[model samples]
Target chain A: MDTKTLCDGILDGQRRALSKAITLVESARADHRVQAAALLEALKAAQASPREALRIGLSGTPGVGKSTFIESFGMALVREGLKVAVLAVDPSSARSGGSILGDKTRMELLSREAGAFIRPSPSQTELGGVARRTREAVALCEAAGFDVVLIETVGVGQSETVVSEMSDLFVLLLAPAGGDELQGVKRGIMEMADLILVNKADGDLKAAANRTRADYAAALRLLRKRPQDPDGFPKALAISALQEDGLAQAWAEMGTLADWRRAQGHWARTRANQNRHWFMEELRLALLAQLTQAGPVRDAVARLGDSVASGTTTPALAVQSALALLHP
Target chain B: MDTKTLCDGILDGQRRALSKAITLVESARADHRVQAAALLEALKAAQASPREALRIGLSGTPGVGKSTFIESFGMALVREGLKVAVLAVDPSSARSGGSILGDKTRMELLSREAGAFIRPSPSQTELGGVARRTREAVALCEAAGFDVVLIETVGVGQSETVVSEMSDLFVLLLAPAGGDELQGVKRGIMEMADLILVNKADGDLKAAANRTRADYAAALRLLRKRPQDPDGFPKALAISALQEDGLAQAWAEMGTLADWRRAQGHWARTRANQNRHWFMEELRLALLAQLTQAGPVRDAVARLGDSVASGTTTPALAVQSALALLHP
Candidate 1:
């Protein structure tokens, strides 16, 4: 379809059109990129007023029941007449040959819901590309009138941090364990989290779940409170996806936090800051790409890098030589 | 002094010459930078054979007794007839107007020792500058026949990670505390550490110190082992810097780890990789500097940044517009 048709179909909340638009954005081809940009611009222009979905970034270690929690929580949201979209940013999928959310069967209930849409994106060997495409997809979903957009990433490496940049609320899901398991959670990730939900809180794990929740609560209290958060925010709660326990409370807490942020103007401010950050980041990446576009600059970088590695020249001196090649 | 005389003095292990050279490297003036590069080149050329020092990066939060530990450790090394150098990288000092190691009286005994040399460097508004200068200082110390160089940084922020780039080993110093305190320690810094020492392990705090050490030991074990580390590496131990306990043991462990790395060829490989990393980083910073230099491009960046922040256009599109201004 052409850009107008794609924009109209997306604005009407057509699943096929949304999927096609996302695929276009994810494409590496130069021509597809141009078309994708046009489609997005058309969508943005077509809207009488901006429609924004609550972008929730969710991250968890492998086997943390992320899909189960999402399925249950998404079902709850859809039951309230909310349109939900789930987008996955699995950078590892490019290397591992499988996206974590590649199989829709994992969220069978949510997938069957008429108000829910799910899509998984591959990293394509660069995190910046993945993030940019995913962010664009989020815009497409918002244009499709989704009330909530869930961005999921594995709790490894820097992907969660990247996800947080595009999200209004960042949630970390964890399996119930003692302090040992918490150690596996990077403090940097913990610091980024607005809410931490300890899954598998039912059956034999209930007591352990409570303990982990308390531990994280204490730990969160020790962290310097961010000005964006209201009082008693960034706390942990225990939930069981299988039992459907604590979902309501979790949802309520999320709503409260979102409402407070919106009231306090942090929501708009944060989105604006995020946009500025991505703009600068994209510009930097584009500039760097110029040096590596199958040119003499690339060759010079390699040659100087070898010299640096061999200790024949200092990195500062090597950088001076490289910059001279660029500016000359 | 001229570069030739400076090189000769450094090679002769003159403290005055080493201090002057470091000041030159740390200067922001263009002329001084050129002179610093010349002096460093002279020293590198003058070395008949590479005199490598065991570069140890030490970091801790304020009040972690870093100075005390360094003092005792330096005295121990000096007692064994080894020359030691301590370099501080305090990024906050520039803004705070107080260097953590500005007062030589903090390490009174070590400061008076003929075998020890100490210097503090300010961040000067950019971490890249601080890291570059500190790395150069490390080279100067090695050239001056120091057997060991300790690069110290406050445990907050990215300074420790930066110091780790220039050091052979990274050590984290912590005061006696429970799991709650450990939660305050960013996991990224912990992962970078090869050794963790719980300081103030004497008097009333000894028991707590031992417990903290064990906790970190467990946490370290849970972290994936790096290939460079030998078996049972990245361990934590308790020590009393005030009482001078465990200093010898810590030194012995460091020596063993360093010797193993040298024997296994990781030492040279790591340094080469570090050099390559720095070369690329410097090149990236230089390219970015070009964009910020006085020109229409800088003005365009500011204008486009405002537009992006206002959400008038998408970041990708904004980047395209910015890049057109550069490459057109």
Candidate 2:
């Protein structure tokens, strides 16, 4: 299909067009990128008034019940007659052969919902590439009239932070555990989180979940409060995705926070900042890509790199020589 | 001075020549950079055998007694017939008018010592420029026959991690406080630390210092152990800069860690990796600088950035337009 048809289908809320557009954005081929750009531009022009989805970024370590929580929470939104879209950004998928979200039955009920759209993480080798594609996928979902876009990333090296950049709200999901497991979470991630949800608050884990919640509550208090949030935000709460308990309350809290941010004008300001940030980031990546692609400059970099590594030349001197090769 | 005279003076451990050479490297002028490169190359060729100083990176927030600790530590080393050099990398100095180490009497005794050399943070506007200048100054110190080069940076923002990149070992200094102050410490910095020193362990605060040390010790245990270290490494200890207590022990511990790394060949491997990392970093900075320096491209970036922020264009499409301006 052409760009116009894709834009029309997307504006009409057709799931098939959204998927096709995402594939186009994720494609590494030069031709596909041109088409993807055109399709996105066409969609932007076709919309009468810009529609936005509440982009929520969720992250948790493996076995932390992330998928279960997402499915439970997504169903709650769907029950309220809202359209939801889920996009995963898994940099590790390239190495693991796309093991994360690879199984189709992982979110069986949510997948069956007509109001819900689920897309697996793109199998991109670099985290930057994966994040860029996922960000575009989010834009496509919003253009397709989704009420909410849930971006999930494994709570591993750097991916969660990347996701947080593109998201309005960053929710960190944790298991019901004490300080040992808490220490495993990077402090940087904790600082970035807008909310911490301690899952497994049912059966034998109820007390443990409560305790974990209190611990995180105290920990969050110790962090310097961000000026953008209202009082008592970046707090922790307990939820049970298994029994579907506390799901409504968590959803309500998220709504409250989102509404407050929107009213306080933080939502618009933050989105604008994010857009500018991504534009600069993409420009930097493209320029660096040119350096690596040029055969002569690439070879010169490698040769000078070896000399620097072996201590035959200083880094500054090596860089000087490399730049000379580029320009001269 | 010419490159030959500077090389001879550096090899002879002349403090004036070392300072001049650092000024050369730190200069942003095109002519100065050429001369600096020539001077560095000459020094590299003059040395009969490469003599390296044990580089230690120290970081602590303001009011953490960093200068006091450095003074005491440097005095101790000087008394032991070892030449010591101290260099500060304070990126904040650019805005603060070099307030961090602006006072000439900050390390009065050490500054007066014949065996100790001290350099304040470079007054560069950007962190990358400041770090690059500091790294080259470190080379000058090593060439001037210093036995130990102490690199100090304020424990705020990304400066500490940048210091860790150039040093053989990274030490985090903390005040005698509890969880509140600990929370202020970024977890990323904690992971990078090879040693944690709780300072002001004297008078009324001795017990508090010890307790803080224990807390950090436990926290360090929770972090995954690094393979490069021997057992019981990256540990915390209490020290008193006022009374000069524990300075010898801290020095001994640093020696032990450094010796272990050298024995395991990690020292050489790490330095090689650092060299290559800096080379690539400088190259990236240079390429990005070109984008900002070109008048047409810079203006286009600003115009496109405004469009992106105003939601008039998607970031990817804006980037595409910017790239076309560059290549076309």
Candidate 3:
């Protein structure tokens, strides 16, 4: 239960300790947060692990067979002598007070595999807080000798984009016959998708799946590609999770893409950028929280906010006035 | 002129004083900034200007006939007994130590018009700083009884988005035979465009202009409409600045859109939001500047930045460590 024991157990690949460590980081209690931070610091400093895990983010709409795809994909990795870890991020989980474990029956095989670890999404209230904890969980998993970490999230709002930032490869799963309308695909999701997979390519859906793959491929070609993408442009493929088909092909493509990125040094650069981004974000959020607590600063924003609302003051000038109070 | 006299002269529509006031705000000198801010405060608090101007943003590629279109548009407005002010925003002007005065010859008629004010883009090093000065210049023009303010910028980088935020309506100008390729359009510019105009539609290019308009209209249909758009999706049209054709139709569309937005309360809401956004941006910039100035904070960042680069530290934890030093 102590930070040292929990960290040691985690480093030793003890499932119980890993679960408990995740809970500690996800906890809202002040004491738990302090202890969790200490454990993370120790784990990070002591981590001399030989090889780092591939952090993959998988996002799909409901009924896209995300759970089934993850199960099959995870099992494939485990079959290759790799230890896999799955961490789900569902911001809407707060509404139902549920995690992705609501249907653990779907991941039966992978859940029971000794080589794979499936942790339910944390039931955290804030998106940023949940994302931070999940990112920390990834570190623990890496230290615990997990060679592959899979992040699963539903394609909704900004959650997918946030998840994509912490990932090395982002895979977007789409169901066959899901209509290729640009309106159907949110702009943010389309822009962030590093690869597109048309799921349910088995039986009657085989032709439809191929058509969907073509449609997505064309869409990706027309869309502006990410500047940091070392693999040129995002490519689309067809897969059937029900039959456990195309899982190996998808995995191979991911490996090739990852390999190219690593060779080009973009992988390291991107990881460093993510760290710096998160660092600045945390600093900004903390500073804002502190600034709001100051009486004079609060008063300034309130008064200036009203003026700005009433069209009496410009935002730039209002900011100037507010900054004066903060630094004075 | 002193701050008070400059403010008074700006209010009185004295061209010399108005130019001087704009120069003051655009100046990087410390004393000039203090004086500029004072003048803005005085102008904002004093001016009970009747009927605010319609802020219109115009952007296009370098050879998209932006200056010709603006000259025609400005002339049309002035002929209608409305005083128009055009403020150009060229962030790259800092590099060449130039504004768009090269086009002054092209805007000869409008430049000599008594009812029009044409100010070239200020040569500012920073985008935010330039944008802030431009916003202030907008307020000064409004106080000086300009009934229509036209903001012109090349559709490059973030300037288009920044200009769009301050404007009541944003118009994106294109040329005939421009191919209308989605890949050619920047995603940010496409998303923010309230109106799409295919300029140079006169004579032989008329057919191509119509085709470009139709293509853009289809593309616009596919884009997710802005949530705050009370007038629905953006519309596309073809215009000819050379023959001064379609100017009236484009002007009428803007008028209708502006009228609808104002009636729906989105006009005021959007302006207030822009103010709040700028206020937060300024606060963040100021906090960052202050943080960098402190020796302890700078030293911590330098150490953590190295760790981040060397892959030894996570960005979130680095931020936490950095915050501790700040708050301590």
Evaluate residue B259 in candidate 1 and report its C-alpha lDDT on the 0 to 100 scale.
92
Candidate 3 lands at a TM-score of 0.68
Model 2, span A1-328: residue lDDT tens: 7888889999999999998899889986667877887887788888878889999999998888998998999999999999999899889887897554563468889989999999988987798888889999999999999999999988889998899999999999999998446646788898989889999999999999999999888878886599777889887999999999888888887888999999999999999989998889888887787667747768879889889889899887887897777666
Scored by TM against the true chain B, the candidates give: 0.88, 0.89, 0.85
Q: For candidate 1 chain B, which ten residues in a row score worst on lDDT? A: B96-105
The model with the greatest TM-score is 1
Every candidate's DockQ is 0.40, 0.40, 0.27
| Decreasing lDDT order of the candidates | 2, 1, 3
Task: List, in the given order, the native-contact fraction of each candidate.
Answer: 0.70, 0.72, 0.45
After superposing all C-alphas onto the true structure, candidate 3 shows an RMSD in angstroms of: 7.2
Among residues 3 or more apart in sequence or in different chains, the pairs in candidate 1 whose N, CA or C atoms overlap within 3 Å are none
Residue B208 CA error for candidate 1 (Å)? 14
Model 1 agreement with the true structure over A129-233: per-residue lDDT tens digits: 888889889999999999999999988888998999999999999988885566477889999999999999999999998999998888898875998889999
Provide the lowest-lDDT 10-residue window in model 1 chain A.
A96-105
Clashes of 1: 0
1 or 3, which is superior by lDDT? 1
Question: Comparing only chain A of model 3 with the true chain A, what is the TM-score?
Answer: 0.85
Better by TM-score, candidate 3 or 2 = 2
